[model samples]
Target chain A: MLVGYLGPLGTYSHAAALQQYPEEELKPYGTLEAVVEGVKNSEVELAVLPVENSTNGEVRAALDALIAEIGECPEIKAVGEVRVRIAHQLFSRSSNVSQVERIYSHPQVWGQASHWLSSTLPGAKCIDCDSTSQAIERAWEDKNGAAIAGSAAGSVYGIKPLIANVSDRDENTTRFLVLAKQPAPENKQHTMVTFCAAQQDLCKTLEALVSSGVQVTFLTSRPLGTHWTYRYIVEFAGALASEQVREALAKLNQVTPVTVIGAY
Target chain B: MLVGYLGPLGTYSHAAALQQYPEEELKPYGTLEAVVEGVKNSEVELAVLPVENSTNGEVRAALDALIAEIGECPEIKAVGEVRVRIAHQLFSRSSNVSQVERIYSHPQVWGQASHWLSSTLPGAKCIDCDSTSQAIERAWEDKNGAAIAGSAAGSVYGIKPLIANVSDRDENTTRFLVLAKQPAPENKQHTMVTFCAAQQDLCKTLEALVSSGVQVTFLTSRPLGTHWTYRYIVEFAGALASEQVREALAKLNQVTPVTVIGAY
Candidate 1:
């Protein structure tokens, strides 16, 4: 199946998409909206977008895409989740890191730029860009500039790292969710879904799910950005082959209005 | 004087603006660009915009505004800095905590949300919003939904807390910078400045600041989102009156080119 994800090329999003399905060719979409749109339009069978990071929490751009697709039911659901270790590299044409006064990279890459600035190119000024790979392109264009980006982004942008594997932390990683236009991956061990609650007691609803034998793996919530209503997203494991998952969902139907955005 | 901030109302930006000159009628603008514009056009004499937060780093919307106004030199520097403790309330119309099914709040409020989501909304789902106050407004409208937002946001949105003060760390607070077209307020002890580095090694530069006798009270770095470099924002106590800070900065000038975004 064709997989679409956010990227100019060599972005963490692109990497995560490839990691989810090793054999599938990851199609790089310019934006998250486009990735989701690709699925909606049947251009791609599945899409992968970042949901959150271990340290940073949620990626709102991806979350927003999920919300926009809520009304478009059965279009997307979590098939799998990929964890990616994030390593930032400082790339430059100049051999000396100290000679780099200007740094270029995507805004997210720049967010983690402090350590590199303090330790390496301490005097470098930062400029933002559309993506990490783009930073490499700019760095290549501007000899005085270095870039803060993924090591792979360096290769994509055709630049070399003055410093490699230079993120401040070793465990730094991002979490990406797999999506598909069809039903969530079938008869599997995990099922991911998003819903709108009819009532306020989300815990109460969750207890109901647990009581019905659903095994929740990951959970998060966000505001619909509408009149005080919220949206709930849950990932649970129940043999997707079993009707038990559907039965548990039926219980939620009795107590509250639950619209499953997607089923893994 | 009436003060406006970048907000839709009940955002941290509004609270930060209010803290500087409390009892001022604080109007929330839809965007930071608007907040700067509000000051430029004299729709409001002063506005509060978050320069950077301790947690997620700089507020891109604000920095981009300043960059766009580079030539105009808004005659503004950060007048004051605020570190507001993030106290999140789990608000639902129903007093029963168990009745809450979904939680809504801004990304900044996430630290406060983990407890409630783990202990309370774990079974429910999570969603992200542009602001904490907006989350409350949405949650307040849904009977089954709850919000993890600021106390100020709850008060304005008419959301009743199922639980009060839920942050992973009590120190969960955000720092905000106050700005105006002209000087707003000053403490001889503190001067907030934004600068571009001659080098990206901010840590070493900060060390130089220390060696030069600059006592840094707070420091934050963020991606400029321009081409590929980031901006390092720092706050420290030293009299601009002393000319010592400038001298130290001038010394740093040799190490890196410095563009003082603002100083007051």
Candidate 2:
């Protein structure tokens, strides 16, 4: 099976893809939208995309792509999830960290490793790249450059790791979702839904779920292309096949149209 | 009054500060944390910091700083809010847009103007800076460089706006909070609260608020330094002094200790 992931390779999404489909053929896509598109077009059998980070909250780009694409292509659904423990390392062409004047990485990586960067390389200029692998490639070519990435990216670019686990949080992890043309076999572990409702109806909508006795595991709100109006993405612990989930979703749909993204 | 903001005089925070205190002495700080520190230390009478953007959702760094600082310094509170309409422009040293080889801006600015950048200057390499004003400074020095910033930044850096309103969304706005040593005089407009609760109690906690008849205006959840545990920040259309708000908060505190960030 061909699996697509957002990458030039060595992204956290790539890591998650590898973990979930160890022996599958992996293809690199430039953006989350493209990865979803690959699955939508059947160019790839499956695709992996990062959804949330332990410290960064929701990955907005991924959520945005999923919300937009799933609305149009109802067949495409999130079928599985993989959690990748993030471990950032400072890689350099030279072993001397003091001489490094420029550091490069994805913007998110820079934020995760900011505490280490400030304490160790306070004077270095931080540059942003599209991916951690791209950062390593750039560092490999620059004389006074360093990059923060995972061990996989460091090995890929033949860069030596000068320091390991530089992120501020030791247990930082990212959650990745596997998207396919059909939903996963019902497991009763979790169900994800997205909907938009007026402020007055939000409580009513949420109450529908709570009164059904399903625990909401995750909830986030994003602006719906307007100033203060918002749409909510919610995850609850239940299967669509269950009576409680079916009843809850029915009531939720009555309050506001609910799109069931997936049940896994 | 002396006001502090994250700035080099051209950032959006600077614009918000100026709008709120046109005649006050404005000082620039390097980060949102520093802006909060300015108020905590009484170095500035008040400070302005961006809290949420319509396009980008919550400003994580700002929220983190506010959460961390408020825990220790309860005297500091958000007293007022200013919503600044975000209008991004492509500013360049040269008039020829085709000649621009690099684009510089804060990471958030890059994301906001990504659509325009991809369509207009598809080949330009984007470099991240600490602030849009810093991006303007970098662009000013590079002959083949352009930056995405507001008109205020363009004027400050003596760069010309090659294109106007490059953001994908026209009604994009950022909500900034005014931080001071004391809460604003009582107003029944809005109140903000934050707290951490287990997954099982989240519905019950929210129900407490809804039962008291306060309309929840905004709600967002961030991981509480753990894998799945989360803390929520919520905004409601009520005042702290209002009977409904006080009753709601008291009920909410029963489920989870609630921190009233401010009422404005």
Candidate 3:
């Protein structure tokens, strides 16, 4: 299947998409809109986007696109939840880290790396870019400049890493979601549901679910940007075969339009 | 009151803080944690953080810290709200935009500028950094580099703007939350709430709130990184002062610990 994602290459979305599908089958798009359109037009079989990061928050374009899709949009079926292992390295084309006068990477990295960078390279500054590879691309032109990105980015932009995994925590990972016209089969172990809540009551929601017997596997919530509205992604187990699951869903339909994002 | 925020200067947060406080009373913290700690230690009378962006997503660190503080610590209190006008600019030491070989900015700026950057500076490499001021600081050390950041960041980092308002959209603005140890005098206009729900059945929880007459103002849900589950920030109208609101919250609290983050 053809997989579409946002890239100039070397973005985590590209890495996660490749991890889920055949690398050779990867098709990169410049925008989240284009990626979604690819699936809608059948230009590609599936699209992958960063749904949320452990530290970053929700990718609004992805969420906005979700609402924009509405009914005629693809049935966002199976979610290939890929947890990207982030290792933001200080990269360059030259010899040592001491020679670096400037570093570059995504702003999220810069925000996360502030304490270490301000201490480690007191004089050197960090530049922000769209992707880690872009940092490498920028560094290729300057001898004193370095880039903070992943090791995978090194190959794409023809550079070497000055240091590896400069992030604060080693357990840094961003979870990605796969959007397609078709979701996976109901026999899948993991299922994802996205819905908007009128209130921020997690307890009552859980009560209703547990009262019906749906074992939650994982869950994440993000804002809908309209003051105090939210959308949630919940991963639950016990297959769609369980009568309790069906009955619980019927009960939920009474509350809101709970879209089955995926079952994997 | 002296307010602190992440800056070399001229980040949206800086502007947002100024909009809220005015009178140029911001302390300009280098890191978000520094800002949080500043508020905690009373280094600044108050601090501001960009909670959500219209086109972008949560300024992750701020959200993480806020949730962690409200849910885990409860030492800090949400006090005020401000709207920041985000004006993306292409900045450089050189006055000519055509001579610019590279561009820099925070990843959020680059994400918002992808289309414009791709079309405007196709050959120029875009890199991400900690903030707009940081990007301007990096570009100042290089002659060929241009940075995309805020107009105010220019004066703060000693750089100049080549073009103003380079974001993909013009209506972009980020809403920041002002935090303090003391709560603001009670206002019924803005109310913030934090709640945790069952990993499954968020719909049911939300239904209880809506059915109870809580008109949501803003909502985004994402993982809190505690127990691998999720928590949400919901903005609603009217304070818990109203009997109906208190009753809804009381009933909602039966299912979850629905705490009032703040109402201003």
| Top DockQ hit | 2
lDDT of 1: 0.65
TM-score of chain A, every prediction, order shown? 0.82, 0.96, 0.83
> Across residues B121-226, which tens digit of lDDT does each residue of candidate 2 receive?
8999988788999998898899999889998787776666988789989988999998999964467488899999767778788678767877788888887857
* DockQ of each model vs. true complex: 0.02, 0.61, 0.18
Ranking by DockQ: 2, 3, 1
Question: Which portions of model 3 show Cα errors greater than 4 Å?
Answer: A1-264, B70-75, B155-160, B201-204, B226-228
Query: Stretches of candidate 2 above 4 Å error?
Result: A155-160, B157-160
In candidate 2 the C-alpha lDDT for residue B54 amounts to 83
Clashing pairs in 2: none
Q: How large is the interface RMSD of each prediction?
A: 17.4, 1.8, 6.2
lDDT of 1 by residue, B156-187 (tens): 66656778877665555565656667653433
Better-scoring candidate (TM-score), 1 or 3: 3
Which sequence of candidate numbers ranks them by TM-score, best first?
A: 2, 3, 1
Number of the candidate with higher DockQ, 1 or 2:
2
> lDDT per residue, candidate 3, B76-96, as tens digits?
777878887777888888888
Docking class of 2: medium
Give residue B121's lDDT in candidate 1 (0 to 100).
62
lDDT of 2 by residue, A1-264 (tens): 999998887788888888989999999999878999999999999898889888777888888998889988988888888899999998888889998999999877776777788999999998878899999989889989998899878766665689877888999899888899996546658888899976677778767877777778888888775767778999888877877778888989889899988866
The TM-score obtained by chain A of candidate 1 when compared with the true chain A: 0.82
